[model samples]
Target: MTTVERTQVFLLPDLGEGLSEAEIVEWRVAVGDIVTVDQTVVEVETAKAVVDVPCPYAGRVVALHGAAGEIRPVGQPLITIAPLDGDGGAGDEPAGHATYREEERAGSGNVLIGYGTGHGGSGRRRRRPRLAVAGEPPAAVGTGAVAQTDPTGPADAAPAGTGVTASPGSSPALVISPIVRRLAKERGVDLASVRGTGLGGVIRRADVEAALADAAAPAARLAAVPDAPEAHVGLAPAGDGDVVIPLTGIRKAIADKLSRSRREIPEVTIWVDVDATALLETRAAINAATPDAPVSILALLARICLSGLRKYPQLNAHVDTEGQRIVQSAGVHLGIAAQTDRGLLVPVLRDAQRLTTRELAAELAATTAAARAGTLPPARLTGGTFTLNNYGVFGVDGSTPIINHPEAALLGVGRIVDKPWVVDGQLAVRKVTQLSLTFDHRVCDGGVAGGFLRHVADCVEQPALLVANV
Candidate 1:
């Protein structure tokens, strides 16, 4: 008796915080593998972080949507799963259900990183499922070139488990979807006989259905034709001194962010040299007095930033060009630019203005630790109104740092070193550092920017000024 088997696709999900696409880092399960709900089927690397995506449906994997290293967009099929077959319900008895339809109707109730099999849930609204070929995977769709397509159907289409490698000077068979291949195989039809209408001659489900109707005809029109000119990459010899490295993962994210910041923001930079001798001495005194609970230079600087922001709130605000308004946030959601082992990361601190120096130091330590460990959640990486970049840690004397986008200004602190200074007409050495403030001109003019930088420099030169302000 002929019966219909149902197939469903598990799509690539929005991981968190509105990520669009992710690279297939590794596949935990393979085709023909049986998987239970909540099983991690694949590990993918989003632009900012790596995440393990769990399967929300329990079924047998019929096909993998893409191979490793391919970047797949959300809502695209990640895997095709065939539910247990049933006279009415295939694995009903084991599933504690009456039929396959019942099991599918019940659904996996749990929501994962924006993915769930449930029809009704509080999670993100599920996307409408697009129908695809019952057997063909997205990768098998087309090679994007006519040269890679087989105009003639050959048994060369690799079956499951046998590595399908096209012979030299011959392109790989375009048949990838098992459904399409199975239909042709069962009907005793040659795939090469069918003329492909898919992109660059990739066969589709409609092609298979059309082939079945004209059984009495000579051959299916969608089949690949005779051997065509092969497309192969010309590679340089092993000793080619320079190697090309692809920008991906965190690196790609940084590149995109920086490029966008430069393109959109009309940035201007203003810098000043400050005598940090008082700041250093102040830190030493506080450390010596506190002994165990010593304060950090960053903590003092953070205090000064909050104080300066109160005086000049414009620099602490963001320009919403689209809205044609400046968003002046009351609480400083401060972002600290930290260079971690993974890459440059800016972890945000919510309501940083309310924290004390000691408290700010602790929060900074925790955020930096989380950033370096790559355990900082997506929430910790966004929503900052201002940024404090300590480029001095890199041992640089000065730098014109790019302003973090959305935020109007970024404060950059340079390496503090002993330098020649005129102290009351006497030439002497004093600890000094260069401070730079890169700001969006649309948000504020040079006067506002200069006022903010000078205020920070004043606090550095005279710590007593911050104490009085506090």
Candidate 2:
């Protein structure tokens, strides 16, 4: 018998609560395809972004564990690979061999976002920070009730502490994962009766059924409760009003992310009113020089930001728990926060320092087109070192932007509204724009953040600062 090496291909783990199970969008390689470590093999779409899952082990794909369109839970098997035998088929599974390796570190396990161990057949969701829900009683500290559901079932519903609101004198809706909610909604289960065993009495589907079984009563047989109004009320039907669509998709994501950021991250926001008149002229000149090039202020700002990042690399960092470790990176992958119909997608421009202004504009144009057309690849959404959000395009003066997670700061560029400014003690109407810088106070204090913003402001104010290419 020809002995062949066998490896178990585990399911891709959730990047975070932002994703639960990703749809297997595409499979780059098939059974019998020889793949090396770090080679892109599959594409998966999570709630936040599409990602390419690289091959963990260098071997021949012997079998596919999951099919395309299958939403495999995190820590489940997605594909299987083995050494080709003389006849066929990968040899028997090696004793105590669990093949999984993370991208951050290659080892005996699969890669996952943030931090954790390799996949070792221990299928359990990693514990995350317990966010306080809005208007809800704190977790079972004094409730004097045993939770009927698992707390960690689905933890992404409430943004940090913006907990769900309950009707006056009514019990708060049990917090549950999206999957559980879907199942309960489908089965018409009474979510209120289901006590959660998960952290803080968050409900799970199993908890609902278990609660039902424990009560020895059918969900349908339970006492009826009055129906609540829809979450989002449409435009007032009684009043003469234009169509008012409820917020959804990109708008919703932005709202949730920003709300969570404001409520959670201690933000130190500073503002600088810059005379971007010269910068505007420079951009017009550049764009006029190359008509085909996309030369919006955002593209220019991106390049300017990249240049300034070299001077203050600490601004392009992420603060892990305890506000201790700030992961300051060398490369500048600027995430252009693009609002798409699907949601707010931050497709990254990897290694922005290498690209020229014109090239950056072209790339942004292409990437933005792709995002608008829904053709952006998975790679485009990953590896963002820092982020830039241009509210200017939408014609806003300025507003503090929430920093994208894992990044230390975010720059919000507002509309270049013509405003009167004191130039050398003289009031003058100039093409003015405001730069709102929101920084993670844990990693960087106000002084350092102020310097970064001032530097950028200087670049925008005195276009010479940018022309000098510093």
Per-residue lDDT tens digits for candidate 2, residues 1-470, read 43232454545665564555666654555444455445555666665555667555644555555544456677766655554333434433222223322321243344664222333233222233333232453222111111122345444333211233343555555553434543443343545555677766777657856754554433332122247332212222222223234454334555777677677678778998888898989888877887876577777898789877888888988766675677888889889988775677888888888988778888888888787665565556767878888888887888877778767888989888788988889999999988988888887777788888998998888767776764
Count backbone overlaps in model 1: 26
Candidate 2 C-alpha error for residue 166, in Å: 37
TM-score of 2: 0.53
RMSD for each model, in Å, please?
14.4, 15.6
Per-model TM-score versus the true fold: 0.65, 0.53
lDDT of each: 0.68, 0.62
Error of 1 at 373 (Å): 2.7
Q: Over the full model, what C-alpha lDDT does candidate 2 score relative to the true structure?
A: 0.62
What TM-score does candidate 1 get on C-alpha atoms?
0.65
Candidate 2 — number of clashing residue pairs? Answer: 20
Which tens-of-lDDT digit does each residue in 394-429 have in candidate 1?
899888888778898999999999899999999999
